[model samples]
Target chain A: QCSLDSVVNKRIQEALKEYKPSIPTKTLSCVSITSSGRLSSCPAGMVVTGCACGYACGSWDVRGTTTCHCQCSVIDWTTARCCHLA
Target chain B: QCSLDSVVNKRIQEALKEYKPSIPTKTLSCVSITSSGRLSSCPAGMVVTGCACGYACGSWDVRGTTTCHCQCSVIDWTTARCCHLA
Candidate 1:
């Protein structure tokens, strides 16, 4: 019985190997979410990777792994670069 | 024989369902590559999601989907936010 089960498992494994090519490969997808003021946030299921701020502000940080906070004193717009596996 | 093949296919489907839990889920991973001067690039297999520039410079663009170029005249540094599915 054990030998038969092993044979069945082996067949299944081979089938899986063939099936893999049919499975769609997932790729990294990203989008920028921009909002007025100093803060911008990623949409649901996305994470903030980096930020861009207006007034030529280079200083920024991520908040809650989803929002980008621009640290410059005079910031007008903020953009959160968000990414996810798709 | 057809019935036997159907049974085997059904078993393989069941095995695949069980096998799925063991497969590791892919997630979005990101890192920032910062370099002195005006340009920075991501490592192989990663794509640039966004960019940051030093000296309070936020004007930046991605070059060829991997490198970040700071556009400010006196830019001191550039950071490329690179991400990939892992």
Candidate 2:
């Protein structure tokens, strides 16, 4: 019984040493709108709306000027934005 | 004034047609533990703990078997898992 208790104690210690909380390293990037009233190309992780370039590029919104929204839904790459419409 | 009203109506119509809600395409991956009491490699955009493989590989947790948590933090690539420890 004493030996079993010792083994259990060792296992508990090992478990304590081995346990680690999961922390996510990757972060999502934010979307941006361009000044020319056009949507811009988003970086790899980001999606472009209303912008005329990059992934998921298309007309997203129109007002006095074309307003576009670029967003990154992924976690690895940082988001980016650029304009193409004139 | 009548011309202004027609132009305004046309603009409203265009605005209605142009509006699109922002939708994210990328999704985050889930974490998992391996059968060998070790952590498996997580695909891109995922964080792994316990199982020992791939990026950010290390011990994440242990029980009857070693279990690792793998997740994808980025958006471009789908998450993957593999075991390295025996």
Superposed on all Cα atoms, the candidates' RMSDs to the truth, in angstroms, are 4.5, 28.7
Candidate 1 lDDT, B1-86, residue by residue in tens: 45655677798877666664345678887777878899999999999877777778867888899999999899777878777777
lDDT tens per residue, model 2, B1-86: 45654555555445545646354333322233233222334444444322222232221343233223323332221112211211
The list of candidate 1 runs beyond 4 A from truth reads A1-37, A43-45, A56-65, B1-21, B63-65
Worst lDDT run of 10 residues, candidate 2 chain B, spans B77-86
lDDT of 2 by residue, A28-64 (tens): 3445534432333443433321122233322122222
DockQ of 2: 0.01
lDDT of each: 0.81, 0.33
Tell me the deviation in Å of residue B38 in model 2: 52
Q: What level of docking quality does candidate 1 show? A: acceptable
TM-scores, one per candidate:
0.63, 0.22
